[model samples]
Target: MPNIEQFTPTEAYEALREDETAALVDVRSRAEWTFVGLPDLAELGRDTILAEWRQFPGMTPNPSFLDDMTRQMGGTTPQTVLFICRSGARSQDAAIAVSQLMEEAGTPIRCINVAEGFEGDLDGSGKRGGLNGWKAANLPWKQS
Candidate 1:
């Protein structure tokens, strides 16, 4: 909450593109990234960092999330890193959690939350990715 910033999916993408040191951290589960698709940052000569905030099948919180994220991101925190999940909730939590880890390691990070997330809000029929989100924004993404 201290150093974390919140942005729309488009804003997050733009910020990452503009800042060479910034990285987009997708906090969704591996299943979501694989089945539901994930953002494609290939044009920026980068990839979306997969640091799941929660585990699949059991949907349990990954206790090693922060540690794993630090390792995944190569220890040095990016100037601006966005955390995104299926919805904004988890990513917001991730931003806070990652911030603490970054501080402990003396690697101050600008943790950001993609407020609309990857799937976006549920539509009238309760479907995802249509109302508003990374996918809804029509940003580059690919199914794995």
Candidate 2:
């Protein structure tokens, strides 16, 4: 019965620093990662995870999301698979999907959904990344 945890950017960074085998999966779309940016988990000396959702524009749950996650996991053993998205919604879904996959395979991997994603809450102009996300936490990140 593996459960999920909510990790702040700083805590997540610290975990990555201590464990080289840990992975941070950015469930954000390619566009968001390109335009907004992503946390520099690699610079902190951990294996940065990558499994971008396969869709466009809106953050809709892809029916094959779990399949893709299984592919990404491949033969790797169950480790920390942190999921992050624009505002944490999609990441939660992703985490649940991944966790279910792991359970089905009897791996029981630990997965977490970042409470606030790359972009936090909506700003005055209804924008994100200004209130409570990775950017707001002042975590190391770079635009791609």
Candidate 3:
């Protein structure tokens, strides 16, 4: 079994900025990406890959997640891929799946989950973004 690594949003951002072969994959739904905003990697000279881990509405798992990820790679395999979602759970699942697929393909890429994700966990007030997450950490992001 392949092991999945974890990184905080800030750490992931730093790693992506420092490593030329590293990429960030946002596994959130299309709706989330449009409404909740997205992590901006423009300054790093890299675009964040948008791949849905789950469909919107019912939140069903996306059947083409792996294929979508492959297509997003654009024929270039990254040495490291960091997955992020609304929170860490979905990204962890994405990381595990990608890790297994990469291992099977003998590519052995490092699949990392962005802990705290984009929105982080719900605070005592039952709201996100207030807790520790990419947005809360004051990282650059933009809405579309």
TM-score of 1: 0.93
- Identify the candidate with maximal lDDT: 3
Q: Each candidate: what lDDT? A: 0.87, 0.75, 0.90
Runs in model 3 lying further than 4 Å from the true structure: none
lDDT of 1 at 95: 89
Best by TM-score: 3
Model 1 residue pairs with clashes: none
Per-model root-mean-square deviation over C-alphas: 1.4, 2.5, 1.0
Better of 1 and 2 by TM-score: 1
Q: Candidate 1 at 79: error in angstroms?
A: 2.0
Q: After superposition, how far is residue 140 of candidate 2 from its true place, in Å?
A: 0.8
Ten-residue stretch with the least lDDT total in model 2: 45-54
Model 1 off-target regions past 4 Å? 1-3
TM-score rank, highest first?
Answer: 3, 1, 2
| Predicted candidate 2 versus true structure: per-residue lDDT over 1-144, tens digit per residue | 346798877677777777766778888777877888878865766444566665767656567666555566674754777888878888887788788877898888778778888888898898877788888999888887
TM-score, one value per model: 0.93, 0.83, 0.96
**Residue runs of model 2 more than 4 Å from their true location after superposition:** 58-60, 63-74
lDDT of 1 by residue, 53-124 (tens): 889978899988877776877876677788999879999998898788777878777888999999999999
Q: Which has the higher TM-score value, candidate number 1 or candidate number 3?
A: 3
